[model samples]
Target: MKKLGLILSFAAALLFIACKTNPFTGKQTLALVSNSQIFPMSFQQYNQFLSENKVVKGTAEADMVKRVGQRIAIAAEKYLNANGYQGYLEGYQWDYNLVQDDQVNAWCMPGGKIVVYTGLLPVAQTEAGIAAVMGHEVAHALANHGQQRMSAGMLQQIGAVAGNVIIDDPRTLNAFNQAYGIGTTVGVMLPFSRGHETEADQIGLYLMAIAGYNPDEAANLWLRMKANSGGQEPPEFLSTHPATDSRIANIRKMAPAAKAEAAKFGVTSFK
Candidate 1:
């Protein structure tokens, strides 16, 4: 039994080593879950969410969500194709909906399912603002941030398992599991979320530009976001997004470059 356990551990370690590559950053990442498995589960959950939620019908806001989502999706495709990632979206089933919620939040699930809450409409005061939010959400999907997060969790789990193997005392193992689980959730996951937020910001800038929305508006939109939220947020270390000041500064720095990128696709301004 011990020999079999040793063989299993060795195989698991080998699998971990084989799956290490950051899809967006192009750095070595520790990923134990494969997208082939993750995508199906995400799609299932997204469909369930749609079924459970009150999806807004043919309203102007809903229409706008679909239109903007399509444009951003196209922009992602064009960008990826131009960069030699021709079939990057092959398995993606893109769907966008406006949910009649008062929460100032929006998110894109893996495999391109998106939901925008009605409460955000005021903050997204214009078509450009909607594009900004949608682009940012879609960027999270395109960048596979969800997958990376799940992968990171799996790595943390593997670490916990290794710790259990090393520690013989049952009490020690239980304590280690509890501590590791909490640490992974609060420490590793929170930072991973912040990284996702930053990546989405960068990619969203370029996507909105390519979709012909003014990249400059992104900063203003975030400013509005800050105002709408009443400036309430956790400390920078605990939050999943950068503080408003940092976000505004980063967006300002990236806007010009995003505009330049849009120009490459012959998009100077929106219709």
Candidate 2:
């Protein structure tokens, strides 16, 4: 009981100090690690990855990646600045690269380091499609999802420690180990992961719209992504991302709002 009490108090205090609002979602999120702590590490890892991978340069495809990434970055800045969050992106050393890989994937690191694999280009199929993917990845960075996930992971670990300390009986404790694994994964972690993906989708659509790409393309992009996957996936409740149909529907509904957001920035027409 004493250990449980201490754990609860520690978690509450940590949550108080580590919470901050995400400008895009306007919701509080954990941020135990600061940009100062994460960016250098992120840069180092990015450089190491580039050294190991075949980073394409001076090619039209590579140029397209850089161009779309820059436009998305500008759109993000515009939205943040107009929303009274100026200077929110300080210390961001934005870098974009295209790598010659067969995986259809893209990602943005904590301090704006972005990598798009060559395999993704076929699915993107156009500049607008590229914007959709880039915008989503950039949104993950801008919203500080990486930091929040780290914070959540720490909390989850703390909870496990508390569980082990509280359950004194070996047989009872073994049962708890089994239950805790399933409970946390299904009840907490999977849902949390899915929520982040949906938020990224919404924020990405807005960014794409503000960058002069039609946000409606986002839904179609996801449709292509689904077709690429051949309908094989874990159940939505057990998965870390929302199901394809749910995401497509959400994107379609958000398109009008995203376009309206772009209109506020004098971007009334989209490509």
Candidate 3:
């Protein structure tokens, strides 16, 4: 048991050393699972999802999702390249699809696999509004939030195992697993998800602006989302995103700066 504990400690230390700085936030982040591993899995899962789901075809909304996705992807590439992170998206197989689902949700998997549900279209009333949502999702992928979450889960698992081994009691082991599971799932994962949402909001605003969309529309888009959700939300700390009020306020604060950034790219307006 002592030797096992030593092995686990060594592994955890190795994971700690594997941290990398996130480009968008410039924060050191754990990433025990590499993109090389995560991206291919994401691509396969995306392909499977498309094959099994009702993917929109030959429709205006479908086209809009693809268009917005491409624009955001281009903006991401430009941003990374300009920041001396060239080829950051080289292995990314960017694909966007509009699914015929009523849930107002959108997500971007690692390696740029994105899905925008049809229910979100009405809320994202215009191209720019759709761009706001798409940019946010893309930012989550680029920031590697998924990888960080996975790494954190692994560490939690290691800790739980060590605790069980040291306690040497089945009841104690069960309690340890249950506690660790909830702590990692609800406490850690939820907050991490919320952080990703906030980061995405910030990065998405800039991306939409660089792609020639008025960043101000981002706040409006959230307003629409809030209305769509019927104003019911989990507490800010427990939820995967900031309260709608907070998000709108943040977007309002950032809009002028985003526009200034767009001006550098010769974009004066979105009209």
Best by lDDT: 2
| Candidate number of the best TM-score | 2
**Residue 83 miss distance in model 1 (angstroms):** 0.5
Global lDDT scores for all candidate models: 0.83, 0.93, 0.86
Candidate with the larger lDDT of 1 and 3: 3
lDDT digits (tens) for residues 237-259 of candidate 2:
99999999999999999999999
Tens-digit lDDT track for model 3 on 171-255? 8788878887887777877878777778888889889998888899999999999998899998887787789999899889988
TM-score of each: 0.88, 0.98, 0.92
* Candidate 1 lDDT by residue in tens digits, 176-211: 899988888778788788877888898999899999
Better of 1 and 2 by TM-score: 2
- Candidate 2 stretches with Cα past 4 Å from truth are none
Candidate 2: TM-score? 0.98
After superposition, the stretches of candidate 1 with alpha carbons farther than 4 Å from their true spots are: 1-25, 28-31, 169-179, 182-187
Ranking by TM-score: 2, 3, 1
In candidate 2, position 76 carries an lDDT of 96
Clashing residue pairs in all predictions, respectively, total: 0, 0, 0
**Of 2 and 3, which scores higher on TM-score?**
2
